[model samples]
Target chain A: SAVISQKPSRDICQRGTSLTIQCQVDSQVTMMFWYRQQPGQSLTLIATANQGSEATYESGFVIDKFPISRPNLTFSTLTVSNLSPEDSSIYLCSVGRRGLQETQYFGPGTRLLVL
Target chain B: SQQGEEDPQALSIQEGENATMNCSYKTSINNLQWYRQNSGRGLVHLILIRSNEREKHSGRLRVTLDTSKKSSSLLITASRAADTASYFCATEWKSSGDKLTFGTGTRLAVRP
Candidate 1:
């Protein structure tokens, strides 16, 4: 199992502003992912943060809107740019560990509210 | 697109009673995992059942998988108030990448 942590446990942001959420893992990981959970909804995968390369975003999500950076195996960041009220949700980061079997561990999550 | 859908979007049960949640998926999966999320918190992995496994147990939590039915069920025995949270079933599709797709989740409220 991996231990993951995210910065800014909760934040209130103004519309049109941006916020960058950070994720750190206790151990080296092979893959890191960003997710968004809307109120009373399931999680939506935002992107797969790739180390030493660009992030692979899912459909309906774009890089210009949610730029991601993975500088190393244990650290990554996701920035929500030009925030709106619709962006208010819980942003979580997860790490995928490869061993005998693959298991993904999630961070505490960052709660962002845009007004 | 969501790969899994859980029944009973919300459930209320008394403490000490058992609670069951069902999840149905659209595609063939290599494995399925159950996770619990408290209000305003991250998800905690409960158990993982592989395609080869039929039933698995972890403490009071039991998970049953049926590949033919393309569905899974999670049963919690002797539930406590702390069990009041949202439970989600995630699937790792065989045709897709290793990334897990999560369902809408079932909110369980165990009243004490």
Candidate 2:
């Protein structure tokens, strides 16, 4: 199992501003992912933060809105640009081994509340 | 949407009893997993059952998968107040690059 942590466990931001959430893992990992969980809703995958390459985003999410950077195996960041009330959600970071059926470990998550 | 759906969106039970949550997905999957979340925080993975596997167990948690029905279930035996949390089932779709599509969670409240 991998231990992951995210910065800014909870934050309140003004609308039109941006906030970047950081995820750090104790051990080097092959896979890093970003997710969003809205109030009273399920988790949604925002993008796969691939190391040394562009992140792969899911449908309904775009790079301009959610820019991601994975400079190395143990760290990644997800920035929610131009925040809005609807963007107020808990952003989670997860890590998994590539090409395996193993469990993915998650960070404690960063809860963002946009005003 | 590719998201899975969980039934009985909310559940309430007394401590020492059992609680069951069901998840149904739309597409074929390589594996199905169950996760637990407390107070809207990051999720803790409970268990994972592959497509070929029928049932899996981890301590007090039991997970059953039925590919024929495209659904899976999680059973927490002898539930405790500490087990009160939201449970979600995520699926790794075949050929989908291991990206998990999460289901609408089941919020369980165990009264002590």
- In model 1, pairs of residues that clash are none
Question: Model 1, range B1-112, lDDT digits (tens) per residue?
Answer: 6558998899999999999999999998889999999996999999999999999999999999999999999999999999999999999888757688998899999999
For model 1, the superposed segments whose C-alpha errors exceed 4 Å read A98-101
Residues A69-110, candidate 2, lDDT per residue (tens digit)?
A: 999999999999999999999999999998797898999999
List chain A TM-scores, every candidate, in order.
0.96, 0.99
Computed on C-alphas against the true complex, the DockQ of each candidate is 0.64, 0.87
Candidate 2 TM-score versus the reference: 0.98
Worst 10 residues of 1 chain B by lDDT: B91-100
**lDDT of candidate 1 over A73-101, digit per residue (tens):** 99999999999999999999998853333
Q: Find the candidate with the highest lDDT and give its number.
A: 2
Query: DockQ of candidate 2?
Result: 0.87
Estimate the Cα RMSD of every predicted model relative to the unseen true structure: 1.1, 0.8
| TM-score, candidate 1, first chain | 0.96
